[model samples]
Target: MQIFARNLTGRTLTLSCDKSTRIESIKDQIYTADNEDGNGISPPQQRIIYGGRQLCDSRTIEDYNIQQFSTLHVTGSLSGGELVYKFIVVVFSIAFGVPILKYVYRQYVSKLIESATESIANAQKRATERVSGAGRRVTNNRLSGRFK
Candidate 1:
């Protein structure tokens, strides 16, 4: 699969990601993770204060299934006096749009080339026919004049 995006600078962008990914589970793992406040949350099922709200301890994320995998993407931009998350939309759009645009462009170019080739062939055919007819007419005129 292919992906495309328009960068903030109006430049072309491309990104690729595998269909399958592997992620470790939050279980049996230690996290000194800080949330921009010099604070760390560890273990699952722990209640911690976040965004000025009291939340359950479900902060630990873990993957234990040998065949299970997860994807984590992060993107942010500082604008409008706040940061906005735009990673998901960008990733999803590029993941599906690039291939489509590529296919459409290929088809369009193929059609153009076909049309040009056909036009050239027809023109060559007409020119050949005209030359042949003119040759025959000149020969006939010469023969008639000789006979007279």
Candidate 2:
């Protein structure tokens, strides 16, 4: 059976597992799992290499028949129960909490800026009124002294 993994970006990768070999033999190296059963599993990180890099750990190939035509394709994925836990803790946390926190922070900063601007404008208006009043009083005193 051909193995496939679909990424978050909607990309699908086809993995080559020989039809003759039972899934159990390649469980650990090709996929991740808590149990040693032959079911397909996903690993967190895997690199695809033809010749230079070793395809899988020796333990993965123990008692498994890998024929000449049976080439293995390795993929990185989160498999089994660990994958579920990671999805709940990491993915759900970021998906829900980040946007809410960002929105609340943005609103608070905007309100604070608006309040500060209003306070500054009020202070300027009061200073201008006081200065104009003082100037008028001085001019009145000078005129009264001249009249007297």
Candidate 3:
């Protein structure tokens, strides 16, 4: 099984382990890959959780029902679950924000189109009136000249 492990330091590793391999050995592999200057964390001290369940050393990855490409969270210490809350909040904000922004944009475009249409119609009306008035003036001038 392929598992993606992420540490609290934001270091991640894509590890391949046999389905029968125990969680304890997986933690050892991660520890070996990034021992990094006497961090002093043993595999037992590192807490690994997957899918909301704390993984135990005695259980195999398959026994815990962990699947391929599953994320394993390894934290040196426990926080107040702030990361989970932030992820939910951001997702909801984007879901609610997109339609509102799209509606505002559509309203703005419709107003612009309406104003342009009105301006064009008014200009056409004025040009038609001017042409008709000029033709009438020319016809009257010709008639009066012939009578004189």
Candidate 4:
């Protein structure tokens, strides 16, 4: 009998098998078929799912009641090496990303402080100039009245 194996990319493989065929054998056949098509997927990395259940290697095709032309979905499984690589990437991102964020925050706060200080200095200078101008006007008025 022949069953169909459908991959994540929607590619279908027509494989020849029977009820007595082991799930492991099916996986091997899938690996071969995929490699022939330049996919390079190994049997250990291939996960076969049918009827919402993952097929076990020790079970036979008949054990799962797989019918003729039944579509078995093939998905990729992450190996230990792949898992380790992903972990390293995440760790590095967090390790470097936090420091960069802190630097940017500090720079922004410094600029804000500097701008506020400059504004306060300008306000004080204006107030002092106004006070000094008033005093000079009062003194001149008093002197002119006395001379008259």
Q: Which candidate comes out best when scored by TM-score?
A: 4
- How would you encode candidate 2's per-residue C-alpha lDDT over 36-135 as one tens digit per residue? 4544434434433333444444333223444444444444444468676556656656877655545656899999999999999999777756643424
Which residue runs does candidate 3 get wrong by more than 4 Å?
77-148
Question: Which of the two, 1 or 3, has more TM-score?
Answer: 3
Greater lDDT among 3 and 4 belongs to: 4
What ranges in model 1 sit over 4 Å off?
Answer: 1-98, 133-148
Count the clashes in each prediction. Answer: 6, 2, 0, 0
Which candidate wins on lDDT?
Answer: 4
Instruction: Write candidate 4's Cα lDDT for 28-74 as tens digits.
Output: 99888878768756888889999999999999999999999899999
lDDT (10s digit) by residue, model 1, range 33-147: 2223433233343332323443233332222111223222211222354222245445555887654545656998999999999999999777756643424533423443434
Question: 1 or 3: which has the higher lDDT?
Answer: 3
Would you list the C-alpha lDDT of every candidate in the order shown? 0.37, 0.49, 0.77, 0.83
Q: Would you estimate the TM-scores of all the predictions?
A: 0.26, 0.26, 0.48, 0.57
Please report, as a residue range, the 10-residue window in candidate 1 with the lowest summed lDDT: 21-30
RMSD of 2: 18.8
